[model samples]
Structure formats: C-alpha cells, structure tokens
Target: MLERLQAALDNNDAQGFSRELGNIAKLRSMAQLAKDTGLGRESLYKALSGEGNPSFGTILKVIHALGLKLNVQLPERTV
Candidate 1:
C-alpha cells in the first residue's frame, strides 16, 4: 500500500493516490481515521475521493495518522 501511494505521488496520479488512500481507509473506519488525523470526516472523504486538492499539511497528518513515514529517493540516472 505504501509503495502504491509512493508511486502515485511520484507519478502525480491524483486518482491513484485517492484509490490507495481508500484502500488504506478500508482497514479502519473513515470516522476513526478522521478523528485520528484531527480532520473532519466529510473533508477527509472529499480530499481522498480524488476530487478535492488537499493541502500538504493535511496529507502529512493523514500519513502520520496511518503510522506511515514519508521518504525521498533520487531518480535513477539512465546511461
């Protein structure tokens, strides 16, 4: 799931990111996740539905709430 999310971010795929987030949300209730992330349930849903553009802070909150860490990797150079 983390790999999928990372790939989505790397590819700038909004729908893919939302899909991956939805998958993770399925593991826990959206309401619970919202509470954990200190975000409103409706707002969270909207943001993760691939329709709304969520703020970076919101994304960070969600990632941390899900017990996930964000890391940076350099792109491979082609010979």
Candidate 2:
C-alpha cells in the first residue's frame, strides 16, 4: 500500500494517488470511508477521484484511518 502511494507521489499524479486511496481495504467500505472523512458520498467520490480539493484535516483523517503517516525527509546536507 505504501509502495503504491509512494509511486503515485513519485509520479506526482493525482489520479494515481486517488486510486491508491480507493484501494485501502482496512479503511472499510466506500460508504464508511466517506463517513469517516466527514465528507458526503459525492465529495468523497470527488476527493478520491482526484478531482476535488480536500482540506488538510480531512486528508489527515483519511491517512490516519489507513494507519499511515505523513512525514518529512530532510536532505542529508541539511543536517
């Protein structure tokens, strides 16, 4: 799952990112995913469909629900 997300990030592709989000099984059914994200079904459709802009908080909840972490990678020279 992480690998798929990483690939999407590497490609900077929204559709790929969204498809990966949609693929999360542990996050529960699509309806549940929508409820957990505090977004309506259509909104969830747009969000994970990669067509709508979602709030950071909402995205955070989705990521958290997926048991994933958002992190920063410091450049080696920054140390």
- Model 2 agreement with the true structure over 1-79: per-residue lDDT tens digits: 7799878977877677776776673357767776766667676666775666666676677887666787867757854
Model 1 misplacement above 4 A: 77-79
Tell me, by TM-score, which candidate is best.
1
- Look at candidate 2 and give me any clashing residue pairs: none
Each candidate: RMSD:
2.0, 2.9
TM-score of each: 0.79, 0.68
lDDT of each: 0.82, 0.70
Task: Give lDDT: candidate 1, residue 13.
Answer: 95
Q: Give the TM-score of candidate 2.
A: 0.68
Off by over 4 Å in 2: 25-27, 77-79
